[model samples]
Target: MRLPLTSRRSHHRSVCVLLSALLCSGLACAQASYRIATEGTYRPWSFKDAQGALQGWDVDIANALCERMKARCEILAQDWDGIIPGLMARKYDMIVASMAITEQRRQRVDFSDKYKDTISRFVAQKGTRQDVSPSALKGKTIGVQRGSIQANYLSQNYKNSDLKFYDTPQAAELDLVAGRVEYILGNMVTYYVGFMKTAESANFAFVGPDLKGGLLGDGNGIAVRKGDVELLSKINAALAAIRADGTYDRITAKYFPFKLM
Candidate 1:
């Protein structure tokens, strides 16, 4: 007996599908796919431009790591208010955002080795020089991003001062511009490249010393859910590869004039 043409084609299709699945498992399609979450409101680290597309150092680094790992990566713009909670809900597989590696955060998620540093900075209207100490800022209102190390530092050390925490850095910047706050605490690189150098921020200048380590903990790192140890290891390997092969430097130079990593 001879098979009908339609049946012959159906049998061939099944075999082709099986072969493709086998190939994907072993060869050209071995690359993994991951979804990354970033707080898109932090400019120079991550934010949307006039066209509403995401950009900045975090986006660049995330893409680079995805490439090095041969993985398809999708980045989502999540609000800082619920970023960590979203991760716990399995909304994303990783966080390539400029999240600091603090002990408190480690209890919930695992982090790759420090891929970048975090330096706190204080900015105010030009010629406004405060000592950046409890005595200097006493009774003054300072602006900080809520749930950030800067906010934590202010609450812990400058208890005498009134600290205003915003959901995003841009909101804090707005308050600073409107004279709602005496000073703004933020990331050093961002305060310089994303704001102070711009014409609108011409009236603003950095005051006090660059801060690191203490309450800020270690540097920035990519974060994964706790127990996702295998994925965390792979991310660290990609980070190391990019740094050694000059990919890291190339990306860093595009946004910052100085070495930040």
Candidate 2:
């Protein structure tokens, strides 16, 4: 039974439409399931609580963004050293750890808009000379988080200093209190939360100039693989929605009553 040429063409068109619909559905499903990675040790940014549940400003923000995007998010914990490499290997869809957006890292991955701004400060025993500069710290030991902007800054500016890197900022703070390092370089917020809140830190004060922008980045932002423009756009839109609806303000206020954003 030879069908007419028109009939055959119509059948082919129908099949093509069905295949297109299926392909689109598959892509949507893939996009809906996003895997986010975070360093589960940086307090107030992303970390696991005593109960082993991840909680922090970044975790809250990530959850809100996921809700707005109507996506199923899976937050995974990865070591700080392997974070960028894991993303490059496609181990996760994005990184929400307190990642500073610098030009050097931009060459490897893309970053979303700055969600929080922070200034770097040097913490030393109270009454210590406030005039100490990065150069003044040369030949002395300084404590900082491994793979942090503070470490990078010291490596570039004060190469002569013996930089001690710790897995967590709390570790560095402990070493600082113990006098293992002459000074500690870290973000202002974390330093305030950890050190200023403690009675012992009353003798410790932040010295030197406030560090911001430039190599340290305007603030902390989420990182995504290069060429993942679609995911990046969606995440950015979600962030904007949260900010506009006052969700961001509420969250920020809960952690920092003063001006931190």
lDDT of 2 by residue, 1-261 (tens): 987999999999999999889878756646588899998887777789888989888888888999999999999889998899999999999998878888989999999988878789999988887765666776888998888888888888888889899988888888888889889889888878767799768778998888888877768888999998999999899989999999988877778767556
Clashing pairs in 2: 126-203
The 10-residue segment with the lowest total lDDT in model 2: 23-32
RMSD of 1: 4.2
lDDT of 1 by residue, 143-162 (tens): 99998888888989999998
Tell me the RMSD of model 2 versus the true structure: 5.2
Candidate 2: misplaced stretches above 4 Å? 1-26, 29-31
Which regions of candidate 1 deviate over 4 angstroms?
Answer: 1-30
Q: In lDDT terms, which candidate is top?
A: 1
TM-score of each: 0.87, 0.87
Model 1 clash pairs? none
lDDT value, residue 10 of candidate 2: 97
- Each model's lDDT: 0.89, 0.86
